[model samples]
Target chain A: MDDEQQEKQHLANDGRQMTLIDQIIRNKVFNCRYWKEDCFGLTAVTLVDKACKLDCVGATYSGTGKPVPFLCLLMKLLQINPDKEIIIEFLKSKDYKYISALAMFYIRLTSKPKEAYPTIEQFYADFRKIRIRNLDGTFAIWHMDELAEKLLSEEIIFGISLPRFQKRWILEELGQLEPRKSVLEEELQNQEQEQVQVAEQQNQEKDQEQGQEQ
Target chain B: SDDGKQKLNDEDTLDETEYALWKIRELKRIKQFNDEKNKYEIEKAEIDRRRNLTDMQRIQEDFKLGSDKTKMEDKTKYV
Candidate 1:
């Protein structure tokens, strides 16, 4: 119960606990019903319960510009400033895509370039279909992989500005990061090798026919 | 027609700010990509131009690429 009095500090980004969400929207989130009711008294440890229950990922809706439960939970996670281990656990959660999505959003907001890229990049393999709540408050199907790629490549998503990170290629060129090998690279290489063998066999057959003609 | 235009304008001004931000970031990312690629191409051309340079000149050229002095020294050993 002592941890429940949790300081009302904002999320830290780039060495400052600044409002990562726009001030107007953050205020709207605070005033939203979901934020007041469900988001109350959530500590870093207890936030997972709410995170697991999230069904859709979105920021604010269009007409009224109302914050969704997903965004409210996101704000709560930001407020609590959970440990790296806890956030990693959320990212690793197998049963809930929303938990992982929430973690990705958290990472994109709080982490430095060195930490954020690899943390989100690994999830590019998660192709499970997930729902994204559009600005119009409509749910649309989005793949887990697309979200990961967007987190890495796009500077903004769901109406939040992700802290800029050095591009992966630049890091690789500077010898600071390794080139990412795609999961499909091995299969593509095998297909090319098989094609080469078939072409070589065809060439041999053509040569044998020419020799017999001579 | 004016009333319809007014409603359309209001709608665009509402949640379209986020979309506008996305578009700006997308354009900026594309520009950065082009700049990085062009820089790479230019560096490759320089390396190719110095294909017949002596070992000492090659080391100097690598240093001019603005990498760390320590890394340049280490690379000099292998060159």
Candidate 2:
């Protein structure tokens, strides 16, 4: 084969081996489960579709026109349905990292707008109340750290200061207490000891029964 | 003999054109197939990544429960 034919064959081979990262990105772009049917969700899907097309056409951006950050897109979604079933569905998806990333983007965007700064406290409060439902419709709560980074970033960007009481309450209620630091540690240890004792007693009883048999 | 040679050359040129056109069509087909495969792969990878994150979160929760059980034991002994 000529050099041109050889080059074409190599390109074809390379195309066949699509990487894992590419697949993950494509799923995010093409899949609708990450978004709801509301305005924010629709907008996000549209923006993503545009991004996919742009990527396909081999267009380069100067970074000035990058689509709204993922978090902003999510916030738009939240605005459309602050407490909708679709929100929980999106959260339940394995793509929580993308969702978290989008949450941070919204926090930053809102913080930057002077008018939106006043709403930060209320947003934080509402966020604390956000509960996700599993596929079976069971409610599942997410951790504070899942929220803290974005909340802190929003606070920093907006210059909105939360009350000390509000901060303490959220920290105490939402933060994941370390295993060693939890008050339940002693109780758990005692249970383990009791279990061991029960097992020993059962063994002794078995031994006596065997002796009787002998 | 010269006329026969000319006719053979024409046939050779026609064959080359046909071959080139076939190759071009094949390349287009390959490109379309790759595009679709890439799209599916991207969606699957995203789903798997999310699943892994959920699993990790569950494991962490189980560890927390185990620790809580230990703590309860310690408290009961002290009381």
Candidate 3:
């Protein structure tokens, strides 16, 4: 009983860690049923298992704004403060999209402007569909590219007030970030090359016809 | 419909919290169903539009158009 009463070693610094989530939202997550049961004592490893089961991404739902399982797991992540490598692994994984989204949401909430923009912009080419649970308990489909765009630009997503980061244009002006290249740049270049080739072929055909006539 | 409810087995010993989670998932499943239905309606509308038929002509061509989820019956719904 005495040992059980002792705070877990990993949770010793939770006071500082708890500041990651907003005060009101943190209280909601702590009081939520999912937090009490599913998120109890979850470490970084077990959290991955929970994240894989998530089908939709949102902070809360049902008009009442009950905290969703995704939000609870996010709060658990804030409490645990997993290593950067783990968070990166979650971001880079292609198999579990919800896990990647969870990582993205965490990065948007916690990372500095320098880190967040470049990290999120890399996923702009991912056009896969994602299920989003709206605040009214309705489901809406959003593409991964759309989610990435919103994360970089939108002030509020999923019901949480994101930490304000410097605008991307400002960062680019300071030469802190490279101007983001569009995914269609290569395709457009290929189309231009094809057009040039077609024009050259027409010129060659005309030259051949003129030579034949001469 | 209550068809979304899963039948429990004797081996399944879920507490109230776990059951609540299941209920939430059930609600999400119903929402997913509606989204799927809406997507089908949108795709069907796109195909119908591509067929180059006027709205009134489309309704006349297909008897089931009255029951269509695309709301062509309302006339102004889509515009």
Candidate 4:
């Protein structure tokens, strides 16, 4: 809730129509300290232009495992709705493997197997050298060539689960990933539903008694 | 002094009106706060529903490839 965050909140409150992903990025990305850099002062307005200039060098937020700003850029790309060929062109590039991986993540999530798989297939060899995160909790680099192969093959790999990668975290944070709800949540939902039912039944019973009296 | 007295006389009737205006303003403030609190709670609950991690845990389930939560739960118990 600093001044910059407040500004983004104002921008969001301005009643501009955005896609769900844009809204998600708008709310969450500025909170990460990664974009707090002198160069990367971001808003929904400048988010796309600044993100296009992003490189792998000095792109990470060291205090946490999540790279919130960079992922916000990736989400911006997805929100823009470019052609499949344009994204395929991105995957073929040699530089900015982190952004490339994000493109891959987006494709794998959004596209059909018939479309996404073949496009990602040839790039597996190229992506082999791209390291995203390690096997442990730390953000120390792990070569993500295997991850690319799995994604191309449509396998789920565990990510570091940080507040960085604001899209994934927000998706998981918003409980859109129905597969991951904890047991406690299910229990609470059930309990609340039952309580509502019981309250409704009691109201009906009271109404019946009042009718009989009348 | 006559003008000042006239102003004071003008102000004397305004206090009752002022009291009602202040009450309306306070009511609006309370309604605004309640609305914001309700919105905050709903948004927070939505986030909580989607979150898989707690502040104390570091290990995460690899929820990729349509894996079962029970099996992932067994594996992620380390964190």
Best by lDDT: 1
DockQ for each model: 0.03, 0.01, 0.01, 0.01
Error of 3 at A21 (Å): 3.2
Q: Name the runs in model 3 displaced over 4 angstroms.
A: A1-17, A192-214, B1-79
Candidate 3: residue A40 lDDT (0-100)? 82
TM for chain B in all models?
0.49, 0.45, 0.47, 0.48
**What does the lDDT come to for candidate 3?**
0.72
User: What's the candidate order when arranged by decreasing lDDT?
Assistant: 1, 3, 4, 2
Compared with the true structure, what per-residue lDDT tens digits does model 2 show for residues A1-214? 4323433464466522112113323233233332233223344445433222210111011232222223224433433323334333333333233353333333333233332223222232222212222223233343223244335433331122322222222233345221112223365579899999999999999999999999
lDDT of 3 by residue, B2-78 (tens): 12112211122346664555445444434553575567668878997858987777767565646564666577765
Quote fnat for model 1.
0.00
How does residue A199 of candidate 2 score in lDDT? 100
> What's the iRMSD of model 3?
15.2
- Worst window of 10 by summed lDDT in candidate 2 chain A: A53-62
lDDT of 1 by residue, A1-214 (tens): 2222232322223323337777777788878888888888888777878877776778988787889788888877777677789989889988887899999888888887777878887775555657677777666666666788788888888777777888777777788776665555586689999999999999999999999999
Worst 10 residues of 4 chain A by lDDT: A160-169
lDDT of 4 by residue, A1-214 (tens): 5534554564577622223233434444555554455224344345434645553311233345344445556544544445667666666655445556666666765665445545554443331233233323223322334454455433334431211222223333466432223223465588899999999999999999999999
User: Per-residue error at B41 for model 2, in Å?
Assistant: 54
C-alpha RMSD (angstroms) for model 2: 28.1
- Cα lDDT tens digits, model 3, A49-145, are 9999887777877755688788888877877778889999999888788899899888887788888888887776665557777777666666666
Model 2 compared with the native: what TM-score?
Answer: 0.23
